[model samples]
Target: MASGNDMKMAEETYSGFIGLVKWGTILTAVVAVIVVLLIA
Candidate 1:
């Protein structure tokens, strides 16, 4: 069984990973928009 501290650490890690992915997707979208504007 997982300890309480271990569960907390895992949750933090998962949340951090999600945040990184979310920001990465946002950045990719912004870049795409900029490129489209430049092309247009």
Candidate 2:
């Protein structure tokens, strides 16, 4: 079993990872749109 501190740390890491992924996806989409506009 994990300790309370370990669990808290894991949660914070997961949250940060999720936030990074979310922004990454949004950035990718925005860049894709910009590229398409430039091409068209």
Candidate 3:
């Protein structure tokens, strides 16, 4: 019961952390591309 909920919460937090990293990398790549275009 409590352990199950704790496990679920831990998984959710890990996934959220991964999602933030993935999106952050993507956002940085996109901004870099835009800057390159502007420079060119």
lDDT of 2 by residue, 1-40 (tens): 9999999999999999999999999999999999999999
Per residue, candidate 3 scores C-alpha lDDT tens digits across 1-40 of 5698899999999999999999999999999999999999
- Reference-based TM-score of each model: 0.83, 0.94, 0.75
Q: Tens digit of lDDT per residue, candidate 1, span 1-40? A: 9999999999999999999999999999999999999999
Runs in model 3 lying further than 4 Å from the true structure? none
Q: Candidate 1 — what's its lDDT?
A: 1.00
Residue pairs that clash (backbone atoms under 3 angstroms), model 1 = none
**lDDT of each model, Cα atoms only?**
1.00, 1.00, 0.97
In TM-score terms, candidate 3 sits at 0.75
Q: Candidate 2: where is the Cα deviation over 4 Å?
A: none
Point to the candidate with the largest TM-score.
Answer: 2
Candidate 3 local Cα displacement, residue 32, angstroms: 0.3
Candidate 2 RMSD computed on C-alpha atoms after optimal superposition onto the true structure: 0.5
